[model samples]
Target: MGFLEVEDLKVHFPIKGGIFNRTVDYIKAVDGVTFSVEQGKTYGLVGESGSGKTTTGRAVIGLNDITSGKVLFEGTDITSKKSKTKNVRKDIQMIFQDPYSSLNPRKRVIDIVAEPLRNYENLSKIEERKRIQELMEMVGLSPESILKYPHEFSGGQRQRIGVARAIALKPKLIIADEPVSALDVSVQAQVLNFMQDIQKELNLTYLFISHDLGIVKHMCDDIAIMYKGRYVEQGTKEDIFNNPQHIYTKRLIAAIPDINPRNRADQFKFRQEVQKEYEHSYDDYFDSEGLAYGLQPISDTHLVALPGKG
Candidate 1:
């Protein structure tokens, strides 16, 4: 079995309206989405804004209530029973998108990182300090800077601090939601490379959720493309990047800025072609309401949402 398996995961929010705030309809944020992550591998969840990437990550980590479905960790169902056990909580952690808002300004770095240790592990003051220091050094931070507040650090430093906190408990899986999107380009590489190093060091599995295809291409082994809360395609990085079947996936891949000046004209032409294809073949890919069809396997490691099945 895979290290983490999400089966038909659905997270729908009630749209309350009218008198007494009665439930009018449901906004299906994550609708019947399913995927799996092997131990010590990174799986990328890529899509545009409001595509349910964040919601899927949140639901897996117990931050949001799952409307229906199962989240299996190591072959055990942790979906409904996450809150009942501290061990489950300790095994799964999250690194949020905005480092500025994720960290509490009022709390010192020591306290912020130690929050998980304090909650789950019965460590003494000295032991906690040592652990936090180890984590700080692991994430390329100074151990002495533990006494500093979140506001005192730069944007990249704050993100490193957040990374330290997430790994403090030695979690097996981390749900990183656009962890480096807030940083500048240089800092973004620094943070992404640092994360890769720690993933190897700790043997951690990452569910990396982001809209930046370039970053995702750098980090992910397997990728899933989402549109309107449903997966349009999922496959190995080679399959998705080298050979994208879905029009939306093709469009996203085409939109990635080509740094080489030699390919400028060719790149522009390719994007135009993909845009024309998307406009003409819109109905072929989507239903009447414009939602992606269910996933159908096209290869051993590739799946795409299309109108008909083989």
Candidate 2:
């Protein structure tokens, strides 16, 4: 019933070995992940490296092929039917991790931003030119910069070009794959604020995948903690922050250091208190098939993964 839903999705890559190269085994990059994104909201995916958060986001956007399961947009499965990919892709756009490499230096900014226009629309010469100028202005770039190449701008400016391109189509769901991870600390907040403004103005949905729990807590209304291609826990922002039920989730929070020793000590004490709470609720989790599915109700907005068996 959500605007976008991913059900039991899996992506596997073959691990080839030996001379003949028979299918030795498969690396489960993403395994049986299920979640939904509602319009005008953000759902964040946070985890360590190799946890398949990127893979899952890629699968939903058709960047990576779906080995199994369904990715539904507006109640229809786009993964099930290849012909629908082009149409489905328009509604969902991705802002890739790197800004420098993502944009082409050879092409001018106008052409780069207009690539999506060419893909989904058959605009006339005058129409394409007009649209590209508007896009440049939308993401805080001057229309004069339209003629400039990627090399003409700094890192933050280049990222603004990427943002312009992503929003050109006015997509409903924007999957930001660590969009700010590459920028300087000062620039990161500016870009983040821009994204927030766009999300509010357009009522756009976002699947923000990042390793930084601090940013996750700042932007996400809800959080899903993934481990080894498994969703170890998921809940609202307040729930995960105030009452984390998973050990991995607690560890991530504790590791976010405050420069002051006193603040750090307080965080350590808080971790100890939460650990005791998790221990008390460990027995309530149950197994589903080969995977353990833990769902503990906390508040109307918060839910925790079943503790233990991680």
Candidate 3:
């Protein structure tokens, strides 16, 4: 089994309407999503905002309630069951999208880094201090500044601090939700390289959630493209990028403002490819169980999800 598995996961929030608070429909934040993450690999979740990327990440971290479906860690289900999640959380950690908001301005950097260690394992105060300082250096922050607060650092440095705090406990899986979106272009690469280096050094599995296709192309081994709470397509990086089989996926790729912008006709062709993928399924195939997420054989290690209703 994969290190992490999300099976038919759904997170729907009730929409209020009418007088006396009638529950109307539900906003399908994450609807019937399914995927698996192998150990020491990066699985990129790509889509526009409101496509359920952040919600999926939060659900995986157990911060948000999963109304249905199963989130499994090493084959054990962790959906709404608190007891099944204890050990799983220790191995899994999260880096939030905003570095500025994620940190506690009141706490010292040292204590922030040691938070996980304090919660999971009862380490001696001295040992925790040593490990926390080491983690600061590991994430390119200076240990001398451990006593400083979150407001003392710049944007990039704050993010580095967040990264330090995330890996302090030596987690196996790190869910990085746009970890560099708040930084400048130059700073973004520095952070990305830092993340890649740590992944190699630590053998970490990352569920990288981002809308930036360019970053996704560089960082991900496998990619899943989401649209309106559903995965419109998914595949190996090569398959999804070079030969995207879904309309939503194709459009998303084209949406990446080309460095040397393509001509109108070439751009038109790209749009067509995207639209073709969005086309309805043939009579032979029926969408399964609202199977917005599935494995259509593009090749080994490559899969695409088609839009159709069973």
List lDDT for all candidates, in order. Answer: 0.94, 0.84, 0.84
Expressed as tens digits, the lDDT of each residue in 1-310 for candidate 3 is: 8799999899999999988788999999998898999999999999889999999999998988998999988887778757757887888899988989999989998888888888998999898888888888899888899999999998889999988988987899999999888889998998899999999999999999998999988999999988778877778898898997765566677766656555767877777665565465422222544435454666776667643335
- On TM-score, the stronger of 1 and 3 is 1
> Could you give me the TM-score of model 3 versus the true structure?
0.89
Candidate 2 C-alpha lDDT tens digits along 135-221:
877778888889999999988888889989998888989999999999998889888998999999888999999999989989998
In model 3, state the lDDT of residue 7. Answer: 94
Model 2 stretches astray by more than 4 angstroms: 259-261, 265-301, 307-310
Better of 1 and 2 by TM-score: 1
Estimate, for each residue in 158-211, the C-alpha lDDT of model 1 and write its tens digit. 999999999988899999999999999999999999999999999999999999
Task: Please tell me which predicted candidate would have the highest lDDT against the true structure.
Answer: 1
Winning model by TM-score = 1
Candidate 3, pairs of clashing residues: 247-274
After superposition, the stretches of candidate 3 with alpha carbons farther than 4 Å from their true spots are 261-295, 307-310
Q: What is the alpha-carbon lDDT of model 2 when measured against the actual structure?
A: 0.84
Q: Regarding lDDT, does 1 or 2 come out ahead?
A: 1
The local lDDT score (0 to 100) that residue 89 gets in candidate 2 is: 80
